[model samples]
Structures are given as C-alpha cells and as structure tokens.
Target: MTSTPGNSTEKRQFHGDLIQLRGDRAAKAIWRRVPLASAGSENSIDEVALQEMLFRHADILALGEIDPAYRNSVPVCMELGTRAGAADALYLTPTGRIVLAEFKLWRNPEARREVVGQILDYARVLGSWSYDDLDREVRNRTQRSPCDIVSEAHSEVEEHIFIDNVARRLKRGEFLLLIIGDGIREGVRDIVAYVQEHSGLRFNLALIEAAVFRRGDGEDLIIQPRVLARTELVPRTVLVRKTILEETDDDPLEEHEPSPIEDENERFWRAVLEDFAFDDPEPEVPQPSRYGSVWVKVDGSGFGGWGLSFGAFLNRSQSGMGIYFTWRTGFPEEERVFDEIVGALSSNEELGSRLEGWKRWSAPSGPPRLGFSRNVEFVDGTTIRDFDEAVGWMREKFNRLVSVLHPECWRRLRAKG
Candidate 1:
C-alpha cells in the first residue's frame, strides 16, 4: 500500500505476501505481512467525515439485516433541533420505528463521558415531542419533510401510516438509539450500564465502533464498523403508554386483514363521500386508511399554519365523525388560533346544545389535529337504514361547524387561500 505522511505510532498494520518456500517443503506457498493502512493523526477520523460516510453508504450499517422486523427503512433526517448538541441522524424502520443515531469520534476522554449523557438528553427531549413536532423540527432543520424524503426513495411506504407509526414510537421512546464512534475508550460500558439501570427510557442503545483506514489516497478509504455494546440483555422498562407490541388481542387498533364487516364499513364511507359537499375549493376527498380513518382536506387552506378537514373514525370502542383543524406547531399564532377555536366551540350555546354529544379537543402534542367529534357505530349491528338516520345527525353537525363555532375563522382561512 502507498504511504502518506502519518504518525507511525497510530497505525495498525495487516501484512500478507505470497512466497515459495524451498527449504521447508518441495513447493510450499506462504503469505508474509501485508501492511494495510495507518490510523494517522489524533483527529484522523473526524465526526463530520464519519457521519457523511455513514449517510452515503448507510446500507453498510445493515440495520435491518441485524433484525428482520426492522427492515424497509432509511435515514430520513440529520442534525435535528437547535441546541449545542443534537441527534446526528433519524431513521424510519420497517414498522415505522424512529432509529435515533449519534456519531462521535471519542478522541477526548472527557468528551466520551459527556457524549453518553448528551445522547440520553437528546433521547429524552425527542421522546417528549409528538410526531408532528418531530416532523416540524426535521423540516425546519433540513427544509424537507422526513416522510417526503423517505417516501421518494421508498414508494411502498404509506406516508400517513408511516408517520403515525413514527409518532407512536416517539410517544413511547421505543426506537433504537445507535451510538457510533471511533475510539470509544474504556469504562464507557459501565456508564451505559449505569444510565440503563437508573432510567425508565424504553429505547435500544447500541455502541458501534468504526475503524477507518486509508490505502494510498483518501479516495480509497475503508471503514470497518462493528457493534461493541448492545442493550438486548437489558431488561425491558415499562412505559406509561402501552407499546404496540404489548397490546392484547382485544385491541381495537390491532393490525389484521380487513374483515367482511370492515368492507361494509368502507363501502358505507364511500357512499357518504359521494353525497357530502362543502364550500372549499376542490377539497381532497376522503380516502380509506388501514387505521379506520376517513380523511378529507381543503387544498389551499394548508398554505397557512393550518388546514380545514373532516374525518370519520371507526373502531370497536368508539366510532365518530369530526370537523377538524389541522394546526401545525411552530407557526405564527398557532397556539392562539387553536385555543381560540376550541373556546368558541365550548362557549357557543347554540352549537354547544345541538352538539352536546360532540367533544372538542386537540392532539396531545406536536402539530395537533384539533377536532370536534360525534360518535356513531357503523360496524356492530347498524344496518344501512340505521346509517341513513345517522347522516341527518352528521349533516346538522357539519352545518353547525360551518355556520356557527367561529365561522369567521373559516372565512379568514379561505381568504388566505
């Protein structure tokens, strides 16, 4: 191998050569030492270069191969959030899990210890955010939606479902946290153990070591990456929210093939979609989704901070129809507008009395989907005739949502469009 001006003390060599041994045997072949490359300077493998290489050849990481269920995903974003230190990369796993990663070059002993705490801090901060919050932050940092970028590369992914899955994982902090570094130093394993022992976080942490080498010019660089620490042996921590894996058979949201009953429900919603009309311009029609939600959207209204929407949700526990406000977080006066509409819905006596059964609330965190819902059962035993009766009730709810309940907001929203 060609040599560069690097410190000889930092190099690790692998040697081999093919030679004919005349004295030992008649015609014996032997291989001598073959020098590969040197480790080079103290900051030879910097974090930026390390991160770039990993991002370029992420397949080399082979995350899915390590666990089959974790397939069909790629790194969706990098350098999320506005802080001194932030997560290096974010990945979307097969089942919509968030794979949080941190790349470090542990040249400084003090930095190595601090990095462990730093990653945990990142995990905690991320865990507190909703999927909408994450998507918003990712877009602000990278100027593109996480799902949009990933979906462009992987067409099979259903953007809405994929996003929902990611949101769910974030809520539970149940994604894989991979800490990758070169020269992680000794006693770091104990620190990982100490954190795991005391924390209630529900994430998988893996310490990966990357050995970078250069043969001849830097163009022919090689990096060998391996897992040095893993959390598989660590006992699972119970989180306040039930993980999708832990839900019992009785779960209404459990993934399964669409039953005959579900087919009927789909047909019913399709008929409703045909009959329902609104003032918004060429509104996006409601589509069938795996999660038993029928969604409708006004196109241009989303240009501002929020959009106007309608939805029909079906499940065992509660089935409902809602008039929605898709308020994204981090927009101008987002919280004020959201709280204003919610207050209007509650205080308007005409709307309140007529829609006594309908409850208004926003999604817990992130870009909240503010909604006013009316529950109805279309699956259990309700016939088409019964559904017809429910239509009148739904029509009244829709009419009131438009005519009452802060009608000026809708007018202003349309004006913005």
Candidate 2:
C-alpha cells in the first residue's frame, strides 16, 4: 500500500468515497464536486446543534424500519437520577422498546466509552419502574402527559395499548442504545462488542456517524447519518429487577391480598359506610379495589338505577376519596345523565363550592368521577384516632353534598320529562 506524495491525496479521497458509497453516494459525490457556500469556515458546529436536529427529526434515526408499528417519544427523565447520570437523548417505541442515545463529537475515545456505561445504568434504573410511574414523571417534567406526547406524533396509537406496551418492555429490559456522533474514530466497535458480550437482556448498542456538510453559506445544512454498527440481538429471556421502593407488578385496580395499610383503609371506610346507613340502611356495601380503595353505589334520586358513588383510597404514597356518577346505559343516555347530574349539583352554591379543588376523570372504560386526595406521611402505621378523624371528615363532606343536592335533584326530576 505504498504511495507517492501525489497519490496520498487520491488515497484520502478514495477512503472518504468508500464511506459515502455505503449510504447515498450520488448525493455525497454531487455535494463534494461543488464548493460549499460559507461566509466563514464550517468547522464550528457543536453537540447541541447535533442533539436538537436529531430530536426534531427522530425518524431520521430510522426506528420504524426496525419495527413498522414503532414510534418515538422524548422522556423527560432521560437523565434517570444522580446515580445513573444523564443521557443526551432518549426515545421509546410503540411496544415499549427503549432507545437510549448519546450525541458526542466522538473525537475523544474515553468520553464515548463513558456514555455506553451511562446509558446502561439508565436501563437498570428503568427496570424497577412501572408505566404509571414513568407516565407521571413524564407529565411532571414536561408539563404534558406521556400519552399526549406520543399521540401528538402518532395520532393512531391507542392510549391503553401504548402504555401497556411500555410496562411490558421495561419489565423485559428490551431497549436499543444508540451512540451517535460526528467524526467517529476507529476501535469504538470493539468497545461496544466488549460491553455487549458481558451485558444481559436489557439493551442492544449501536453507533451512528453523522457527517454534516454545508450546502451554501446559508443555513442549509445537509446531514448524512450512516450506521457504523448495527444493533445487537436482544436476548429472549426476561430479566426483571424492581427498584427498592417501586409499586408491585400487579394492577392496582384489581383485587389482591390486603396489606397493613389496606386493612386500615377498609376499617375507616366501614365506619363511613355505617354513617351513610343512617339515611339508607340498605345502601350498597363498599368494597376495596386492588390498591385498597373502598367504593359503593348510592341513589341518584331522579336518575333511576344510575347511581352516584364514592371511593376512599389508601396507599404507601397517598390517600384520597372520590365521588363518581356511574353510567347506567350506553354513551348517549350516559352523557345525558352526566350533564343533568353535574348541572343540578352545580346549581346549588353550597354543593358546587364544596366540589371545588377536586380532580375529574372521564375514561373510556369506566364512569366519570371527581376525586380528592391528600399525601400520607405514614400510611401503614396510622393510629386508630387518625382513622376516626378520617371517617368524620368523609361523613361531613358526604352529608353536605347530599343535603345541598336534594333540592336541586327535585328540580332535575321536574325537567326530565
């Protein structure tokens, strides 16, 4: 491979052309043949610009080519925590496949290796989280729900399915780690291989080299990204390791064995139900949801069979109560009843004012409801006196709501015809 001084220039061009040929050779050659428009030199591009460009045009990463149904999202908690360190960019697929990425200039070998370990650590932290926690964190950090973020980009995605997929994938440790940079040097693949060899079922790592060229001195930057190394095969075996203080994998809405806090929650709600019985001795008995939320149906006066209900909940994190209007029929009749009931309650100044500060929920799978919750510092270890105070608080709120709504309810009955 000896070359004369004149041949040295040709040798460099040949090597550059080989890299270009792997992707779009025609475009690369045409751009190379022309002089780039620039008032000054084009060597000052930084990593921030690279990160922003990739985030805006994530499809450029070609994630869908791997799985046609897969879509991308930017999680606000990409840095994970102080222990896992921060990542440059993060993405998730439709089926909950995580794509962790870092953008570097790749001029430094040590920095590149460090990013690989950093992203891997993020995966370990993510393993302990459920979709609910991630969704809540995403909303807290971005001021937008994770569901809304994904739906904005992929309008066709179903919310429940998307969320379910994320839980499944995180539990299984199925993720893709991309290390993207400009001017990637040699020996990076060896580093990826060594890490991949010892790694388990969590993630597959890849390297992409982005070559940025200027079209004219204008802001027309042309970026050509080529995959230096493809993603490694994910293991079929699932490896799940829960974070120390995370929720159990069981669905919170389903019935499960009662915990200590659940027992206390049940006792408190039972006393409240007895107070409710002073008016209607045979009112439906309250039962506990999987997370120990006590709920039962109450008469809606003119609504007939369609009842109003309340739920009292307790958990290690917080405790709360909710008032719901259960739908008796299909969507058309249900909506009519909801409007009528809400309107009556709102017309009563006392009842409507009390309902303020409550949160509302209208999901497809269940009836519409309003809820109020308070953080609990000691859920499982609350004193019996505390439970008595909770029962009294709920009883007072319930009596006030029912008393004020009674007159408005009669008005609703007269208008129903």
lDDT of 1 at 119: 82
Candidate 2, superposed: residue stretches over 4 Å from native: 1-42, 65-82, 236-417
Predict model 2's lDDT versus the native. 0.55
Clashes of each: 6, 1
- The sequence of per-residue lDDT tens digits that candidate 2 reaches over residues 1-417 is 675655432221111322234264455422321222222435556677767788777877766554444445544334433236656666765445667777775544577677777767776666556665566556655676666766665665545445556766666566777788775555677777787666654466778777666543546666767776755565533234742222334323222234443355556666776736424343454543223344444454324534444444444322344333344445454446557767744576666676665446663435565545454345433434466676676676554444443344445544655
Q: What C-alpha lDDT do the candidate models reach, one value each? A: 0.58, 0.55
lDDT of 1 at 101: 80
TM-score of each: 0.50, 0.49
Q: Please provide, for model 1 over 115-168, each residue's C-alpha lDDT reduced to its tens digit, 9 standing for 90 to 100.
A: 888888887776666655676788987788787777777765545456557755
Q: How many clashing residue pairs, candidate 2?
A: 1
